[model samples]
Every structure is written in structure tokens, then in C-alpha cells.
Target: MEGMNGRSVRGVEGYTRWSLISLAVGEPVLLWLLLHTLHDGGSALAGPGVAVLAVLVLAHTAACIHAMIAALRRVDPDRGRRGLLPLAATTAAVLVAVVVVLPLDGPAEPVLASIPRASAVAVIGLATIGALSARWPMRILAALTVVVLALVTLTQLGSRIGGIIYLLPAYALVLVSMIASFRLTVWLLEVVRELEVSRESHASLAVAEERLRIARDIHDVVGRGLSVVAVKSELAATLASRGDERAEREMREVRQVAQDSLEQVRTLVSGYRATDLGTELAGARAVLDATGIRVTVTGSADGASPAAQDALGAVVREAVTNVVRHARATWCTLELGAPGGRGAPGVEDGEWCLVVANDGSRGDGAGPGTGVDAVVPGNGLRGLAERLTPLGGTLTTTRSDGVFTLTASVPSRETA
Candidate 1:
């Protein structure tokens, strides 16, 4: 699941980056072609001048695209500014490209013909670079619009007023759209990265909370008892040094206090090892639901003894963990009760049963005589079997038709 999510994030980032690059390159090419067709009824491919200008425009746009991608990679808002040198070089290259075309000894119509292509390339490059560098999209759009408009107007100074009017709005629209697209893409990537970070942080916090809970429980169990033992042992030593007859009795009481504290600690550890069936079921449901798996729980733990419940709860915990981590199952059913009609031949009456079943089994560990132990050996199903065997419980697993089921049964009449 983690790998799948990571791939999804990287896929989105790659797609967005290339999509922006494609737009940066394609828009100017298409615009130049269209303008060339409209202004002169000749093929855009017919002129050497057109080819040279196309190469220059493509080179400049490629530089801008590279800079934009680099900027996007450094999405952390807290980091120092980056890609500035690339942005500056690309912007300088755009000016150089425009100036190289300015001195062509041609008719005003030819000079004017080249203006829109240069303007389009400049607007796209500047808008993309500004989108990455500027903190605010609107500011970048406004500034890009002014810069592109002035460049176009100066280049077309002796040309038609109508051409300036036509080019200005076109450039403004391109600037607005490019800025908005780049900003939105960057924002989306940032959000995805933050979600991944948040998930990791959430897991860390859960582990920390569990540690704190254990620490608190340990303190409650041993803190006062150990303090009492320390005080009594000191008193006993003092009495013995003064040749008091109560010294032996004081020492015995100190030993008893220490033994009692040890017993209490053992009970605390036992409680940690035992899991509540009801709590485990609820937790399993919540966890599976969060992962988009449907969980159906039936019957109740009320009929089972504490030991039977603990064993079955452990079974549930292991089964649910496997389903989440390996099975890729879409639905799971947890049923706990007497075996009833589902019992095997040797199973007697009055026995509690836990049946955990799910679809989408991977089949690697679901063969005859195999179990989750085959998938995750040593401490998985083998451990569960070891745990249940002491209580006369049996663990069995089977897989068929893309479903895996684990059944555990124990005598509910047995005392804890």
C-alpha cells in the first residue's frame, strides 16, 4: 500500500511536469503556424527564416521548461529560493532571441510577422518562470502581462494599431492561463507530499501514544510498591544495627512487599499480553474500513471465557493484519460463536469458534496444510497455533476460489 501510494504521487508529479512542458512547447509552435498561415498564405515550413526562428523559440522554451521543472521540484516553502540562475539565463536568452530577429533588413510586414511568434514565446517563458519564482499568482500574471505588452508594443511601434490591440489581449490571456496552470500544479504536488508526510507522522504519534500508555501502566503498578520496599528495607537495616529484636520481622515484611510488587508486575505484563475480543473486533473494523475494506462482524464475545476470548482476539488481530498487509481483500467477515453447522467432525458442542474469511487471497500461503505461516513464517500463524494449542484450541486455514479462511475453536467452558 505504501509503495502504491508513493508511485501514485510520483506519477502525478511526472504527468504534471511533462504536461506543462508540452503546453509550453506546443502552444508557441501552434500559434506561430496559425499566424503564419493567416498573415501570408504560404506554408510555415517554406522559409529558412521561419525554421531558424522556430529552433530559437524551441530552445528558449526548453530552457524555460527546465527551469520551471527544477523550481517545482523544490516545493518546500521553507527552503531557500532555487532555480533562479536558470530562470535568469532563460529570460536573458529570450531577450537575445528577440534582438537577433530585430535587425533583419526586411519590409515592415516581415518584421511585424515575426513579432507575434517572439511575443508568444516570451510571454510563455516569462509567465512560467514568474509562476515558479513569485509568491503570488496574481502578481506574476500582472507583471508578466505588463512586460509582454510593452515588448510587443515596442517591437510593433511603426506597425498597425489594430495589430497591437489584437496581440495585447492574446498575450494577456496566455499569461493569465500559464500562471494559473503552473501555480495550481505546484499547489497540487505540495498537497500530495504533505499528505504523505502527515500519514508518517500519524503512525509515529500512535506508536508514541502506546509507549506512553505502557509507561503509565508500569508506573502505576510498581511506583508505590517499590518506594514502600525501599523505606522498609532501610528501617530493617537501622533496626539490625541498633540490636533491635524487630529487625528480623522488618526484613521479612520487606521481602513480602518486594514479592507482592513482583507479582503485581507479572499481572500487569499478563494484561498486556491478553487482548480483549470486543476491543480487537472494533479496532479491526475501524482499520479495515479506513482502508476501503468492508468488514462484517457477527455474534459476540459474551459467551466465551476470558482465555478463549483472548486467544480468539489474538487470532483476529493476526488475521486482520494479514488482510491489510497482504491479502488485498475487499471484504472480510469475522464470526464468533459456537461452531454450529460449520463445525468439523471432531469438534464437540459447547465450543467457541472464530471464523475469519476474506476474498482476494494471494494464494502463496493458502495451499493444503499451508497458512499465513507460509506467507509470513515463524511468528505468524505458527505462533498463533502455539498459543491456542495449550488451551485445547485448534487453528486451521483453507483457501479456495480466491478466498482464504482461518478457523479457531476452543472450549468456552474452560476457566481462565
Candidate 2:
């Protein structure tokens, strides 16, 4: 008992430290002392009676061990519903052990006085383990355990009510101590398990927060720089058409803006720049809607590969910017969906599709066509394509009837 308490004090696993050690070491040692008491006190069992009692004790010990193991197995979450069978076996064994040691043939089969008390202790200890492993609201089992042990002790000690009064207090103390020890072990195990779960949750939350920070930094660095460059490039084109000297200066400004953006990108990448698909999608809808473009977003970003998510997010950012800065149309649709599914045409299996289309192409500006009628791919579109190529994806642009559409497709893992 001291060793058990000491091991627990030093923080050992509950089921192992308490249940295994107690059943294997504690029960045997206690049983030895109990059997010694029976022998020393002159038990008058002869021949077959002695052999029967020995067998019963062995069986009871085995049953108790099984009960302890079963209790430990169901210590957590399950609350030891599976331990009930072992508990019953152990209880039955204890009762049999009691009957074997009792004076069933009156004075001729008189047993040692200590044998019944020892059996009661064994039964109570098993009951304590059962109580510890069992789920909540086991008041009935607890009451029954106490009543059964008390009755068993009284029946065995027949006409020894004075001895019962003297020994009962010590037996009660033993029972209380057993119960308290088991409860403490169980509580400690729960706390340890909870702490482990909390640690894992904290780690996951930290990773998500870091990802969000990186995404925000990339957005701040890239989005502002790109939007400014677009506006300046448009201004430069207009000035050059009007034969203004400021056109050359505006072109220089555009070059400087591009250089600055390149530097910003390099710095952000060195700091591990990243973006979340969901965040980028939400931002695209907000920016496009504010620019008087009817933005319709469909599908979800869940279950997509991390590489694909990053690529699609970049596409969303670039496509929305192009529509706002260059495309002069009113309606735009963004769809992120599974490929080779309903409403999707020309998309192969194991692929996720991102389609951004706008009917805002200004005829006077660049519109999709060949030679003079063709709209050339800009820096944004080119950069987006570069990002997708490494992820085993393809990007294509089409313009028909003044509608400009950018479609991106990346392979995806099948979900379980």
C-alpha cells in the first residue's frame, strides 16, 4: 500500500501504477498474510476441505486480478461498463471463498475468525475498483457493496458480535482508503489526458494564427502595390496617346512602381508570405461588389490541397484586381468547384476548377481577339500562370462577345 501510494505520489500512470501493481503484488502479499492467519489460528478443515479452500482462494485471486484489469481497461471515457462482468466474477469468487472457510458443518468444520474478514476486505477492494471505473451515478452499487460485505462479515463471525464491533471500524477505514486511492489515481489520469488534448489544440491554433498573419502581410504588400501600378499604367497610356511630355514621366513612374513591387514581394517571400483561400475569396467579393460589378461566388475551398489553395487564392486576388482596374464591365462570376461534376464542362476528373468571368471588357481597350482585336496578357495574368504551373495546373483566358473569362484548373486528391 505504501509503495502504491508512493508511486502515485511521484506521478505514474493510474491504470498501470494502481491497478496492475495492486492486483499482481498487493493482492498476493495480502492473501499470503490472510492464509497465514487462517493456518496460525488453527482452522480445523481436514483433507478435501483444505484442498477445496486452497482452490477457492486461487480462483478468487484470479477473479480479483481479472476484475482489476477490466476496471483499468475501462478507466477513461467508457466508465468501465465492460468491467461489470469481471466485478460479478470477483464478487462470486469472494462469496465462495467465504463459504469454504465458514463453519458449514457447525463445530466440526470451524474456520479461522480472520478468514471471513480477509474475504470481506478482498470483496470491498474489488468493489472500490469497480466503483472507480464505473460511470457516474453508481450509488446503488456502492450501497449494495457495503451492505453485502457487512452481512457476509456478520454471518461468518456468528455469535461474535463483539468482535464485529471491534473489527468493523478498521474494515471501514480500509475500504475508505482503497476508494480514496483509486479515485485519486483516476482524477490524476483525467487531468493528464485533458492536458495532453489541450496542448495539441494549442499547437493547432498557433499554426492557424501564424498562417493568418502571413496571409495578411502578403495581402498588404502585394494588393496595394499592384493596384497602384495598374492605375499608373492606364494613366501613362492615356498621356502617351495625347502626345504629352508627362507620358514619359508616367512611364518612368510605372517602371519604379514595378521595381518597388518586386522588392516588396522578395521581402515578403523571405518572411514566408502566404495567403488563405477563404480570406482571398471573401476579399475578392467585397472589392468587386464595391466597384459596381455584380460578383457571384460559388463552391467552397474545403478539402482542396494546400498547394492548390495557395494557387487558387492568388488567382482570385489577381483576377478580381484585373476586373476592377482594367475590365469595364458590370457583371462578374467566380466559381470554385469540383471538376467533371454537374454544370462543369471540359474539366477532367481529379481536378478543382476556378473560373472568373466578367462581361465588362471595354471595346476601346484590349478585348480578346487576334492581332489588332486581341487583348494581350498583362503582368498580373502572367504572374498568376507562373504560380499555377508548379502546382500541376493550367490557366487559360477567353474573350467572346465582350466577356473576358479566366479559368484555372488544378488536380485534387479524392476525399474520403
Candidate 3:
């Protein structure tokens, strides 16, 4: 699952280390080659050395093939390890070292012959089939260490330091550790890259899930209340137009309906509000009409995607909210106007905009104000600004004559 440095462990990094072991073991191949070369005692690269070079290069060739397969298995989160061909080529050159630095012990005799001839074929077979293992480090270390130690211990002919039999094992161990460390480091980088990708993916998923949850809650609170308020308000308006005194009684009931809805909306605003333009308009009209404030609205987009419509609706809702709650208005006009209609000159005609204006009454404390009671920064207004900002829109508020006005300019999707 994880490594000492908080890095995820990759099973195939073991194969990469094995390739390095193959490279380090090249020195011994060269030594064996030189010993195998030469006719009698004189120096010559012709004759048997030609054949020795092939065998020396062959082991490195095998290592190259191993590296290639290891490279292909790599999965990258940052940098891809797609081709093992280069690693294979690097390992292959180790065989050439066998040809160059090898001591001429005269004729290729029983040098590498001691290796288990049966397993040699098996190792070659495994490499060709793209087989790999976890115990690869232990296997390579033990096998190569034995071979290198034997060569160093028994063969101290005419060097400055003559006998150093015990030192071979230590040097072999150190060599293996260094090569393994380099490979382990590379693998670690790869693993880290993958983890960072995973973290980003998880974070993005969390944000999307949160948005969906908020949407659901808003629908639950505002959806039912708005529907009921709409039906009752429509009845009140119909009755008032017909000059019926019974309309006044229903109007009282309308007031109760609106107040109950406002209470529920107030509770919701404390938690989260998914107030879009349509819902806010319905709620705003209900609230204002019940308070005897005449409401006028215009320029709303009739048919649009839910998201665009929702965002536009928030503009109206928040504007109407501030007007009803703070403007102390007797009459409020809600306008989802076109861009360039009056305030903005250059834009097109149908660039649907929002303008909510309310004419104030004398000390008209008839409605509850923005929730100063709970001391929470009300989402009713703040949420509106936050939503519109992302769409390159503008929301402005000002007061004129006894009326407070809030206008939101939402550019059409094409221009936006």
C-alpha cells in the first residue's frame, strides 16, 4: 500500500532494480571475456576474443530486454515511463564493458560456466514472457554477490593489493545497495505523481457532491412553499380585480400563507438557499402582495436551461428580498430587463436583465427585515452576488426618490 517515505509501492519497480544489477555485473563479464580471449600468451583481439565479445554482450543484451519489458509496464501520473528501450540499451552497453576491461586469462574456459546452466535458460525464458517478481532484489543480490565475490577472492594475480578475499562480499553488498537505491528513488517519484492525481480527483468530486446536496435542500424548502403561495396569490388577485369583499378575507389568508412561507424560507436561509430567479420571484411576489405592496415584474426569459434560469432567478429573488426587507416600499417593480435598455447603451435588446425597484412607505415596518436576529450574514443577498459574479454579470443597488432599486445585468449566453 505505502512505503517508508509515504510513497505508494509499485510492484514492478523491483524489475527496474534487477536491470541495474545486470549492469553492475557487466564488469565480471568483461573479466571473463578477456580471460577467454588470446591464442596462447601474446596480446591479440582477433581469434577467440571475437567469440568472447558476443557472449559478454549477450548478457547485457538480456538485461536490455528485461529493462524494455519493465519500462512498458509503467503507468504515469505525471511523467510516463512508456518505453523501456533506452534502459535496455543502457544495460546492453554493460556487455561491451565485459569486452573492454576484462583481463586476458587466456582462452574462454570454465569462468561463467559454473552458473546453473538449467536456470540460465529459465531466467531467459521468464524475461521473454514479461514475468516479474517481488523477491527479485533478494534473488539478484544473492546470486550476483556470490559470483562477484568468487571472482575477486580467487583471482588476485599481479595487483598492488594482493589478497582481499573477505572484502569482496562487502563491496558486492554495497554495489547492490547503491544500484537498488537509485532505482527505488525513480519508482518513488512515479508513485508520488500518481497520488497527486488521485487527490485532485477526490477534491473535485467533493465539490460536485456538495453542489448537488445544496440543490436538493433548496428545492425541498422553496419548491413546496412557492407552489402554494402562487395558487393563493393568483386567487387573491382574481378576486380583487372582480371587486369582491370576500377577496379581503382570502387576502388575509394569503398573508398568513406568505408569512408561513417566509418563516420557512428564513429557516432555510440560515442553512442554505438554492434560490433561483423563478422561485425568488414567486416568493417575492407572494411576500410583497400580502403586505399590500403592488409588485410589477418584466423581461424574464421564458424558456432556458434549468441552470441559466436558476442563476437568473437568484438575481430577482435577492433584489426583491432586499427591497421588501430593507426598502420599506409600498410598491415594488421587478424588471428582468434587456441589456442596453436604459442604463447600458451599447448592448443588444434581448440581453435579459433584472431590475427590482420599490417605492418606500412612511415608516413601513410592515415586513420582517433581513435576518439581523440570527446574526448570520444572510445568504439571501450575498448568495445572489456570488452566483452572478462567475457569469461576468453586474449587480448594482441604489436609492432614488423614495424608492430603492437593485438592478442586475445578465448578458445573454451568446455574449456572456
Candidate 2's residue-wise lDDT over 1-416, tens digit each?
21122223235455544554464445545555555555566656456755665565565555555545555552464544555665567556656655655443222222324444535454445544444432334475467557756665656455544555555566567656655566666666656555545555755886899899878887898888889888988998998899988989988988898899899889878545466788789988876654446789988888777778888888998888888777666778999886555434566777989899898765553433552244467888888888777767778886666777788888885233
- Candidate 3 at 397: error in angstroms? 29
Predicted candidate 1: what Cα RMSD to the true structure?
Answer: 5.9
Q: What is the lDDT of residue 246 in candidate 2?
A: 95
Model 3 lDDT tens row, 238-292: 9989998778887788788778878877887754544355666776776566444
**Candidate 1 lDDT tens digits, 191-267:** 77666676667668878999999999889879988898889888989999999989899889988988998999999
Clashing pairs in 2: 329-360
Q: Runs in model 2 with CA error above 4 Å?
A: 1-11, 14-16, 23-25, 46-76, 101-141, 224-258, 269-416
lDDT of every model, 2 decimals: 0.68, 0.64, 0.51
Candidate 1, lDDT over the whole model: 0.68
Best by TM-score: 1
TM-scores of the models, in the given order? Answer: 0.71, 0.47, 0.33
- Of 1 and 3, the candidate ranking higher by lDDT: 1
TM-score: the better of candidates 1 and 3 = 1
Model 1 clash pairs are none
